[model samples]
Target: MTTTAHTPPAETPPAQAREQFRAGLRRPTSGYSPGYAQVNLIAVPQAQAFDMLLFAQRNPKSCPVLGVLEAGQYSSELLSGGDIRTDIPAYRVYRDGELVAEPDEVTDYWRADLVAFLIGCSFTFEAPMLEAGLPVAHIDQRVNVPMYVTGTDCAPAGSISGPLVVSMRPLPPDRIADAVRITSRYPGVHGAPIHIGNPEELGIRDINSPDFGDPVEIPEGWIPVFWACGVTPQAAVMQSAPELAISHAPGHMLVTDLPNDQLQVP
Candidate 1:
C-alpha cells in the first residue's frame, strides 16, 4: 500500500494501474508508475462547467489544466481505456460545497451533466526528484504527502473562491536548489517551490499539522518546501459550495498514459 523508493518498485503500466484501481485497490498513487503522469480530479455539474474552467485559468499554478472530458463524458485519451468514474483510488462527493461521502468508487454518484477536469499533480515530478538524489520525505516514510490550507487567498472566479493549499516535502538544505531546478522544468505539474523555508510567511502556523493528507516527518535542519497543490481546487469546492462536486481523495491520483518526460522542458 506504501512504498519507500530507495529501490524503485517495478513499473506498472497506466492501463494496469487503472485496472487495479477499478478493481478496488485504494492507496496514494505516488511511485506506483515511475514515468507516467498522475492527475488530480474534480468533476462538477454541466451548468457550472464554464465557471470551473475560468477558476482554473485564473489559478494556473494550482490548477494546470491537463486534459478535460466533455460534459457527461467519463473516458479520455489521458488514461487510455480508463473510466473516470472508477479508475481513481478514491473519490470525495460534495453537495453545495459540503463533503458528504468518500468512497472507493464513484460510479453510483456519476451524473450525466457532470464535466471532469484533470489537473496536473506534483507527484508527476516526484520520480525525477528521486532520480536526482533528492529524497522525497512522504514516499520514504510511506505516507500521503502533507497539504496545508494557507492563509493566502487564491484569485477568485465567480462563486469558486478559496484559500491556497500547498503540498510539503522536507529536504536538506544542500538539496534545496536541486529540488527547485528539477520541479521547475515541469511547469504543467505545479512547477517549482512556492515557499522554501518559512511556513509562517505562507501563513502556515504549524508545519506538523496539515489540513489534508498525513503529516510527514521532517528531519532536523531539513526545511519544509511547499508547492502549489492540485488539492487547491477541492479547497475552492469546499468554500464556494457548488450544487454538486466530485474530486479525488487527497493523495489518491489518477495514473495516465502520458509519460513524465513529455512534460519536462529543456
Candidate 2:
C-alpha cells in the first residue's frame, strides 16, 4: 500500500509540499502550511462531466465545486500551477466505481478525456478554528479526520447520487457554539456542523469505526460534530460506477495558493 506516513513540515510552502508529493512523499496533509487552502480532487471522463457538474450543483454542501479543469489539463489556474496528477500526496484509482489502487502518483492514469474537479475541503477551516482556541482532534492527534457515510441522501442529479458523507470532530459542549460561529464564515469549505451529538442518528453505528480516514477518541464532555465532506463525491461516484474516476485519497488534499482567509465570507 502507498502510505502517507510522513508529511512535510508545517513551515513548508504549498509549492514545496507539492514537490514532496511529486517526489513520492505520501502523507496525509492535515497541517501542512496552515494558512494555505487545501482542496479535494476528483477527475472523471469528460463524457460524464455534465452529470458531475449537475451533481455538485444539487449537492452543494457535500460537493462544493471550487474549479473544474479542461479535459486532459492537469494544472489549475486557481492553484498556482499545481499539477493535479502529481501534487496531491496520494491518489485513489476507481474502476467502475470500485477503488482499485491507492498510489502516490497518478501520471500513468492520466488520459485525454479526463476532466479534473477541485472541491472545497473542510481542512480549510481548521486554521481559523484553532485560532479561536478550539481543538481539532485529528490535527492534535496527527491523524486523518474520521469520516462516515450518513443515512441522509444527497439530492440526485442525472446518474450521480449517493448517501451524504461527513467528517467528525469531537468538540467540547461549551465550545460548540464558537466552533460553529468560526466555521460558518467559510461556506466555500463545507462550513459548520451538519450534525451534533449522537453518531447513531446519522447511521454511523460505530463512532470508533469510520467509513474513511482515521478515528479519534472523543474526550470527556465533548460531542461528535459532523461536517459535510468532499469525500461525499467519491462515495457518489462509487455508487454511480463511472468507468473510471480518480480522487485524492482521504485527507491527502491538493494544497493551493489561495489563502484560507480568502475563502471567508462576511
Candidate 3:
C-alpha cells in the first residue's frame, strides 16, 4: 500500500510526535514537530564503534555527529528524555550489510554491545527556509526529499567508507541564493549546498529517479540543489558489512526536544 504524506498538526509537541511513532505511526517525519530538531540514527556493535566515529569525522559534511550513546544506552543526554529505540517511526536492520527488516521498533533487537550514533539531519533547516519564503518542494508536494548516491567519494576511515550521499531540492533560480544563506546559519545541520545545478555532474543519470526517498516536481526555471546527507553513514555501514547495524528508514528521523535555533551557528 502506498502511504500518502500527512503533515503533523502544527501544535503537536515533540513528545506527542514521538508518542505517535511509538504507537506505530510509520510516516516520513519531514514536516512534524515544527521548530524541533530531527536526527538520523545508526546503531552499531561496540566492536565497530571506532571505525564509525572515524567515518563520521572524515565526512563531517555528510555525517555531522550530533550525539553518541555508549553501549546499550537508548536515551540521549543531548536530547533530554529522548529514547532511541522506540522514538523513531521506522527502523532498518542490516545483517551482514544487507537490509534484513524494516520494523516499527527495535526493542527486540537491542544488544548490550551496541553503540548508537545520532547524526544531524537537513530536515532541521527546512523551517528556517520556509520562514524566509524559500520554497521546499518536497514539503509542498507532501513527499520525502529526493536523495542520490553521488560519484563523490568520502575520505576513507578505518573499516568504513563509501560514496557521498546527497539530498536534492529544486529552487527557483532567483531564490537559490536566499535558500543557501538561510541554511548556512545551521552548520550543526547540513550547513549549505554542496552542489547546485546539473545532476549529471554528480553522476546522477536521471534527475527523476533517485537512489533514496521520493521525487518532487522541478518546475520550469527551477534548478536542483544538492546538500550533504546524514544517510551517507548508512551507505558506509553497508560497505563495511558489519555483523549487525540498525538505522532509521529513509525519511524517518528521531525527533528531539532540542529546538532548531539551538543548532544555528553563532
Candidate 4:
C-alpha cells in the first residue's frame, strides 16, 4: 500500500529523503535517521522465515537481529511503527534463485504468507568507531562499503548456505587491534573484522573492483580490514531462491526504534 520512489531525488534535503525512505523500506539508507536504529531488511515466505530467523540467530555476528514480523504482517511493531512493506527505499525480488527485480516498494508482490525481518547493521557501530577516532573509509568516500564473498562458510540452515560476505575498510596497522576491540563490544552489529589482510585469501581477486559497492582508496599506511556484512542474507536469498522473496536493496536500510548505544554488549 505504499508508493515507491525509484529515482532518487536530485535536490531533496537528506533528512527529508531519509524520512520519505523510512516511510517506505529503503536500504543503504542515507542521512542519519537521527536516534533511530538502521537495520537490514529480509522477507521470505512463512515456511522459510523460521529457518531464516534461526539462521540469523545462529549467525548473530553476521545477522544481528532487531525484530521479525509475523507472516502477512507488514508492521514491525516490536521495532516501532515501521511498515516493513514500505519503510525501506528499495527491495530486491527473487524467484527460483535469481534476482528478478529491484523495486522502490513491494506492495505489488505483497503476499499473505510473507514474513519480514529487521537485522542490525554496521552503521550503528560506525558511530562509535568515528567517535573513537577510527576512520570509516566508505563514509569518508560517501559510498556504500565495499563487500566481497569470502572463503568463510556460514553455519547453514535447511537449503540456505554460502560463503560469508565481508565489507572492507582500510585502517592503519597500529589502529587495527583497537578497531577490532571497539567493534567487538557491539556484537549485534557485526561486532568485529573477520579478516584483516590479504583479499586474495578471501577469494577476492581484485580489491579495486569489489563484488558489491564502489571501492575506496587504500592509502600508504593503511591495511584493508573486513567485517561481516548484512548483505549476506540477500546473497543467500538469491542463492537459495525460495518462491516469492523480498529484501531491502543494497545500502537502503530499515530504520528501527532501538537506540544505537543498545547494540553494545555490556
Candidate 5:
C-alpha cells in the first residue's frame, strides 16, 4: 500500500468503498478511501448514551466526537447513503460488556434503542503520513496497526471508564518530527503522537503481542510512536460491562463522505 510522494495509489471513492462493505467485503480500513475521513463506531442503548457521551468528553484524546446519531438513527451527514449498522467491514457486539459476536453485518443484533457515536480515527491521517514520505509500517507490511491497552487510566465519566488504548507505528528517528507535524494538523482525528519511544514506558509489556489488531514487523532503528485510539470506548464498554454495545471491530472502520483535510487545522 506504499505510495510515492506525488503519485498516491488510486484511491477508491468513499461511496464506492461503503458500497463494497455494504456488499460484505471485510478488511481493515487503514488505506481505504485514502483521502476521505474514516471513523470509529460505538453504539449503545439510549439509556447509556449520556454516559458514553460523558466518557468521550472526558477522554477527548482517545474518543474525539466526530458526529452522533440519536436513538434509532443509522445514518447521518458523515455516512450519507449508507446504514451505520451494516456499512462497516465488520462489527463487534457486546452484551453486558462481553463481546458476544463478530459479524459482517449487525442487522440481526442492532436495536432500535441504540445511539451511535462516530469518533475520529488515526486512519484519517495515514495518507498524509505516507504523502509526507514517512513510512507507515502497517500499511507497508499489509497488516493492521498494533494497539495496546496502556496501564494509564482515562478520567472516569458517569458509569463509563477504562484504561487508555493506543495504536503504534514505528518510524525512523529522523522522521518522527515530520510525522508529528503532519498528523497534528488533524486534531479531530486523534491528532499527534501521545507517546514516542519505549513501549514499556507506556506500560506495554510486549511490543510483539498487541491486545488488539495485528502486529507488524518493527525494523531495527525504528521507534514506536503511540497515538490515543478510538477503541478506548470499546475498552470502557468491556470494563464497565454495559448491557448492550456495538462497535467496529478493531482496525475496521466506517469510511465517511467527509474529506480528511476537513479535520485539519492551520
Candidate 6:
C-alpha cells in the first residue's frame, strides 16, 4: 500500500508550532527563497524592547536592526508582509543562558508581553561578496560559517549584555581588499571585517574549532577575516534570561519584503 505523507502549508500553523518550525528548517532557501529579504529574529518581553533597540543603535555593527514589533503583534508593517511569529522556519527558545527547546513554531509561547525584533544577518552580505569573486569558504565546502563568541564586549542596554559574536571567512590575500570595499557599502549587514589576521587578538583560542557552525580549510596564502554577526543579539537575549525569549535558529532567516540590494548605501 502506498502511504501518503502529510505536509503543512507555508503559512503559520495553529498547532504543532515546533513541528512547523522544524519543517521550515529542513532546508535553507537562502538566495532561492526568491524576492524575499532574509531577516534575523529575536523575541523578548515588551518591557525590554526600548532598551534592546537602544542597544542595537549603540552597537550598529553587531546589531543592525531592520524592524521592531509591538507587543502581541506578529505582522511587521515596517518590513511589509513580514510576520514575526510565522515567517521564519525555525526558532530557539532560551531561558537564562540555556536553550530549553527549539520549536518549529512559537505561537504557543507567543505572549502579550513579548516584543519581536528583526535584525540583519550576514547571509545577505555574502551574496555580494560571492558576486565580487570573494570566496565564502562555508558555501564552497558545504559547511556553515564558523561563529565565535569573542571577548569583545557589546554596548550594554539595561539588563541585556554579552560578548560580541563574529562570523569568519578565509580569503586569499589578493581578494581581501576587494572584500572590504564591497562589504563596506553595506554597513547595515555587518559592513566589514572586524579582524583580518590573528583570531587570538579577538580572544578566539582555536582556529579549527568554533563555538557555532563548522570550520573551513585555511589554505596557504589565505588569511582568516571576521565580521560582526547578528547572533550577537541572540546571545545577549539568552544571557539576559528575561523569563522568556525566542530567536530564529542560526541561518534560517525570515524572508522579508525588502530587496537585498537595497542594503547598500547609495
Candidate-wise lDDT, in order: 0.90, 0.88, 0.88, 0.75, 0.90, 0.74
Worst 10 residues of 1 by lDDT: 1-10
Model 1 lDDT at residue 151: 94
Q: Which parts of model 3 have CA positions greater than 4 angstroms off? A: 1-3
lDDT of 3 by residue, 1-266 (tens): 12457664576788888888888888899988898989999889999999898888888889888899999677866556757888899998999888888899999988989999999999999999989888999999888888999899999888887889999999999999998898888887889999999899999998999888988999999999999999998898788889999999989989888888899987
Clashing pairs in 5: none
Q: Once superposed on the true structure, which residue ranges of model 2 sit more than 4 Å away at CA? A: 1-8
lDDT of 1 by residue, 44-149 (tens): 8878888889989999889999999988788988988789999998899999999999898998998999999999999999989988989999888878889999
| Candidate 6, 148-258: lDDT as tens digits | 989999999887888899989999999999998988887888888888989999999998997766667888989999999888988897677677788877766666656
The candidate with the higher TM-score, 1 or 2, is: 2
TM-score of each: 0.96, 0.96, 0.97, 0.88, 0.95, 0.87
Provide the lDDT at 211 for model 5: 92
Q: Give the local distance difference test score of model 4.
A: 0.75
How well is each residue in 162-222 modelled by candidate 5, as lDDT tens digits?
9999999999999999999988998898888999998998999999999999877999999
Clashing pairs in 2: 4-26, 4-27
Worst 10 residues of 3 by lDDT: 1-10
In the range 1-266, model 4's lDDT, one tens digit per residue, is: 12222332244433454468756434455335544467888888888887798888888878887787788677745445556766677778888768888787778888988888787787777777778899888777676667787778888888676668888889989999989999899888888888888889988889998777667889898999988988888778867778877887766776666777777888
lDDT of 2 at 74: 76
Off by over 4 Å in 1: 1-9
